[model samples]
Target: MRKHMFFSWAVLTGLLLVAIGCSDVSEPTTPTYETNLSSDEIKNSAFKSEFPLHYETYLRNDESEIMTEYGGSVNHNKNDGVNPLPEGYKYAQPYLKNLWLGYPFSYEYRRARGHTYALKDILEIDRINRFSEKAGLPSTCWNCKGTKMLEWTDEYGDSFWVKDFNEFREDVDLDENTIGCANCHDPKDMELRLYSVPLKAHLESEGKNFSELPRNEQRALVCGQCHVEYYFQDEKFGAAKKPIFPWAKGKDPEDMYEYYKNTGDTNIPGFEGNFVDWVHPVSKTPMLKAQHPEYEMWYNGSHGAAGVGCSDCHMPYVRLDGKKKISNHHWTSPLKDPDMKACRQCHTDKTPEYLRERVISSQEKVWNQLLIAQDLSVKAHEAIRMASEYTGPKPFNYDELMIEAREMCRKGQFFWDLISAENSAGFHNPTKSLDTLASSQQYSQKAIDKAVEAASFTTARDLAGDIREIVPPILEHSRELQMDPDHMASHKWFEYIPLLPESEKVWEGNERLTSENAH
Candidate 1:
């Protein structure tokens, strides 16, 4: 009986090795193509004839109607709590407009669509100043929009970054220039390559070379090129407005905060040598606005620490033709797949329903804490605003206390923004997400205490109320709304900003609309 069992086990092991050897799913092999395209080809369509199968999957990014419980490809307003479907969703965060007041994000910010819409969406977004001939952003804003950066950078060098964003609007092709194959692959041999200058520079600064890293790490790095947190360089640094990843100290929220403290040339009394994204028009506090930091948030999380790269879940391998396996190019949430095949790739024992429920459960906890942190942050801002304007008897350390309050407000909001801006809804790092929110609440509460103490507790009652009622969500705002006298007078916070001069839309997409070409 023992001899028979040993022979059966040996035969099973041999069969397994044969299966692994025949299947590309077990170990990916480099695909060879005979395309005669130019090495510098940036157009998505240019590679279609040579790689039809891959191109078909790439075009799948155009599907934008799907919605997960917490996120989706629908291009809806993230701040609207009352609207429905394509316009807004039930899971909306109401205070985004109030929190981001005075910044362009307050003008218009929406849930992101798929990668195919990058160029088109940016051209139409209100955040870019469509009402004026000059876009309010620098050309550096185009860094992640498309592959045209390769040609633009080669032609203009570092000078490409500081130019007006609108200058290249008419110069790009909507379908061809949007993010595609060339952004992550070398057309010559189809090997993964880094096209983002910011990411490349960051890797070099760390004395690491992308090509030398393991293939799994390279897969994540390709996506990290744009999915990570970044800020434009101050003029005091090299190439003004050039995009830079703040990874000098480390990739954690606390590490990034420490790095920003001395990276800028700002000379404001308390903000000296500090990087300030914008001054909160209401709180009068210098603030740091965090962009999506998915890469940072995931770096030390459960999967990343275990050597699972982003592509493992987001771009799962699939036999699209029912023969050769290829990485699915329709980058999106794994929960969108009915089978949750991506999760099952590693979690083979769990059912799709079970995996999805776990994700939503974690997100629900983070979302609740996120709202609480946001409320406290808003209260802190209001407390500072009231305290600064107080005429009552003050503490001897009023000035000192007010400065400390502002500092806390800054720290609290930034910590909150780090998690708020990340795309995973806290599933990326649940422990870190909850911990960060707790810190944010503590700092914001401290700010409120200091502000109240600075006023000798005179304004405590003024700040005592449901924050939702005290600071109603700003439901409507835009460059156009800012010009309307009635709209400008609708909110107390609006009183801080001057009304804009009446203006008409000057451009649409890549076209400069003159009377002859106007729609």
Candidate 2:
């Protein structure tokens, strides 16, 4: 009997090893990220598959209902214990650009709680099936949320891979219900992990040991898996196709533009014609726009200088029941709990006033400068608009003025990015934030004025207008910086979750395949 039990244990271990492997938030505020898809609808789905049936059997055999036990409260709308999404879910943008920027969930709640909010495994697929039918969503929506679900996507990727979340969820057969512990944290060893082929390809090419970085740093990088902004270059185009980080010359936005200039060859997109942003409705000289610009600007600030990463304060590890170690997944700003151990770990001071003072002062300086950026941005837009009007659509050389305005606008946004990065705006350094913004704005305004004047009838259109690009050899440098292990934007979710092979119905191989192989 003892020998039989031991053999049973070994078999179970092997099966689990073959099971899905690999891989927050805050809130008394209630995890704002609950499922918008109806649970009843999901639970009611009629489709049954080998994946879903297998998960159901596993759950029944294991009796896993940890969500109700772990989560302190049940979701109010879902009516059952599994929490529904926040009130804001109705308005969430499909492409969620601003999310995971350290907002939504609080830090302590994230630490205290693991992911007890969503469906997983086969039951999750049932939920996916039901939810899609009820909510009118898609099954492809299940991608990246579960190993089994991601497995189902094998061979079917080219068609449904890039499809939107709702529509995707509705059409596909899902065993993966949503993002869960099995996706980010290694349930077998319980370390945060990435399961992508491209990430390692890029990292190794640049000599990065993703594991060598400190745990705190690791925490921040983990956030980068989904948090940072990225776009697919499209495999069909034979372009890089893999997700490209914007940091060739430097992580700075200007550096990114340097790469985008692509002056070396006519074959590159938007290079020879010298396109930047769409005709600045205001500053007619094409302007380079920005999304959040948080990652780069944050790096330029003090916290980053001190080697502080987002997870140091936001995803601090806490011991539960006196011994279990886990980092909080709640993805919110650390400032939410000032007195708690969160920010105090680094600040080393007890007084809220002093902390506030520091953040305010730092932010003020940056803010002052940012104001200049704002002024420059608005003024530059007007200048461009005025220039375009003066010259008509034929394209004239407001080059000097545009050079001035574009630089300022770029700097202003950079400053703003820095401010928004730190909790309490650089531990209360509003003064510096203000100062930086102010300076940037002034420069931007100057550039706009120059461009506006140049575009006037007094100047002839310089078809030969010299293209003076800033910061040389942008892409080479950007690629190098992007592949750096310490950098966050380096994450390549594009390859992190690949479609499974059609021949294999299994979610995982018999063994842990090397983390990455070919790009």
Candidate 3:
């Protein structure tokens, strides 16, 4: 489920600088791959190879402006057997939300008004649009921009376009950016090329209408487009539904769900409608779970509204010795190397701690909310199980119940991601985490009661059916926390990374640890 864009290929496959101007031939393009400066002296570890994670960034940097200077590694520990880079390199922790800069990009953007880019902020579409306006981007530049949602047709296809995932994989290249240059720009002619077979398949899926949009819109269609969040439903599940944006109703979570419900569509059909992403464990009512929502939320925020793009902040122009070129495609937070023109133009406060503290504080706040949401959601499921003992089953709506369960599971997942996306853990803004947690708790409790209410109608005669049948898939998919590895591991204690004791539960399947085993 985790696409792993950053951690997976953040440092993989490099582009070879071919004979600079003689690139108009039909020769196979070659790439130099991961740069050597990446690996430690002769250490050819995958940590430095294909899809390598630069140990240097993870190993060095200590800006006094914040608490931790170095981008702290989940794998960093004395016993982990590797000595980090030279001292003065403070820890730099990251949330997926921002650029991997060493200093605070947000604070700078705030001080600069509008000319500057908050390079360390999360990637957004408008940001790119503005950048394109500032720097002339040719038509071919549109390649790596988006999902290319060109319409297909009114007529259905007799055979599947992408018959299976393997065929899909062969045709698509996911090596760089989970997207990259070759997808759009012609490496050979510096022109644009479209594979008719592939585009034809796409057109047919949409009732054959690929060329309906405006020229610039079509040009803008590639690259930055798919960079947004989306929902996918497969043809096998119901009728063939192609990947479509749910924005016809409107944007924002509430608006989208309103459209789905009005459509009389019981569920997503494939993903199980279950309403929105997940349900609260405590609040039994269906709830909306949010993802990066990078485009929507970022646009509404001070950053995107002000006009910032993914490349503007995270992937900015870097002067190599004096010749200017965009920083290599190693996508990460700009905070990892702050003071770049992208950020420095705004953040006049040159201190590292100042920058780090800001992001850390924000991260911490998000994590706290995550924990609260997770705990309450789990408890609500337990409540569902308890309530089930008193219910009856008359041709239970298994379809609907599963829908509910999937929603709750996702709510729990959202918390985990919030933690993961939170760059500063609890350091960014402690209050932010506290505020979100409080609301999350309230919402979760509300969900829990709803599930109990669902089963309250059961009679003695209905008891013969699978107790699970009436419980709705929401409770069924809760995965009995005791047996889930993530849930079980969540209870274990770490000297450095601690969990709330109140949140801990004894494993139903595992035995207690002995004194010797505890170590």
Candidate 4:
């Protein structure tokens, strides 16, 4: 009987080995970035080795592994607790195409993924690579990607901003670097330090020195280095476009808008002048694209006001090898923690499942309303196009009407982008998010009404007829806009939760649970 059992086990083991040998497990799907030249490959091949204490092997390739493990089979939405998107569902809002028309983002924009993917994803985007001769990207674009930025800044100083993106792409083999240990750590002690020059300068301009801040505040400020909204201003440092944060006025959505509108009145010395990121093709309004302002948004929230730093939630300490406790370097959404250790640290009353439901419920409310704002903005653009060509009678002067509608467009887009671009869906501060989305919807609707009213003077009724439902035929429209022909065809969403399905299907909360949370 013992011999028979041993033989059976041996045969099973043999079959498993054969199956493993035949599988593609030996070949990893992710590109192998190994360089042929070990020490001789790049000039600063061992640059990080110079500060051995500061550098650690931080690249965990955690996106696939973690998403598969904690996030549920690689297709689950980390925050919302939803599985992969269903058929015919698009991860990107189709209205975004209309909103960003005449801009590179209109060609392609995907939801952000892990820190490890930052450089690779940017390099692969169609928005930056539509043209052959020059990639539609500036060197300043690399600011948030990785730790090697310090070396590049030391070498080029301010001239780095003007250099074409490809210049650095060719010179620096990006496969070797990421937002690693060196980015936030000091070389000697591994203590936190802010390396972003723009952030340091901006803080100084406000008479609030970053280094003088308390350690807890500094932790979040390190993240603020890249997470805040900034614009590239010409001739501030050199001819190169230097990134200037609009913090002299304030950090709120309204404050940033006012600062952008009246740049000459800025309290930040030496940056007093009007700035324009891009002119909206449809509305002709000079638009501001609010980058992920997570720092700014959180700062205005209750938690941040209570001195909770970003690391508190996102980089909670985890025990490694069951002995050494260290902050998790795989910076990602805290919701992916199956153990709910991070959330439970603060919210002792709630379970992981409850927290997940609360998050999805809050986000769903904001997102559904956001889509309305988007649709309104699209219609506003169509109305503006009609009003521009109209030789109509004037209740308000044509140019004045155009200016008014454009102002609405500007304000609407600003509010919408603030909420939309922020990494956290409304969970950071539900009240603030809802309020901002409300303003966005109000402004968007006003823009549409203003545009339609102006277009009424035109003799051609068909021109302004049914401006509603005019989502730009973006798939076909890109061809007319001179974008890459194959961009839409080649568009790819992340494997995890690629397309958010209907709320009922993706979200798993009952009415009783919803009622319980409402209180």
Cα deviation of 48, candidate 2, in Å: 24
Of 1 and 3, the candidate ahead on lDDT is: 1
Q: For each candidate, what is the lDDT?
A: 0.90, 0.39, 0.35, 0.63
Which stretch of 10 consecutive residues in model 1 shows the poorest summed lDDT?
Answer: 510-519
Ranked by lDDT, the better of candidates 1 and 4 is 1
lDDT of 4 by residue, 206-292 (tens): 788766787788889888998888877656434466677888788888888887766532332222354656666755666667788
Per candidate, the number of residue pairs that clash is 0, 93, 100, 1
lDDT (Cα, tens digit) per residue for candidate 2, span 112-227: 11222233232222112221212122333343344443344444544544443333333332332344434444433345565433344445767878788666556556555533
Alpha carbon deviation, residue 421, candidate 4 (Å): 0.9
Stretches of candidate 2 off by over 4 Å are: 1-179, 195-201, 209-216, 229-242, 263-301, 305-307, 319-326, 391-439, 455-519
Give each model a TM-score: 0.94, 0.50, 0.45, 0.74
Model 4: lDDT equals 0.63
lDDT of 2 at 18: 63
Provide the lDDT at 32 for model 4: 26
In angstroms, give how far residue 518 of model 1 lies from its true place: 13
Instruction: Count backbone clashes in candidate 3.
Output: 100
Better of 2 and 3 by TM-score: 2
Q: Model 3, range 226-314, lDDT digits (tens) per residue?
A: 43334333344333333334455654444554444433233554344333433232323333333233343333344544555444554
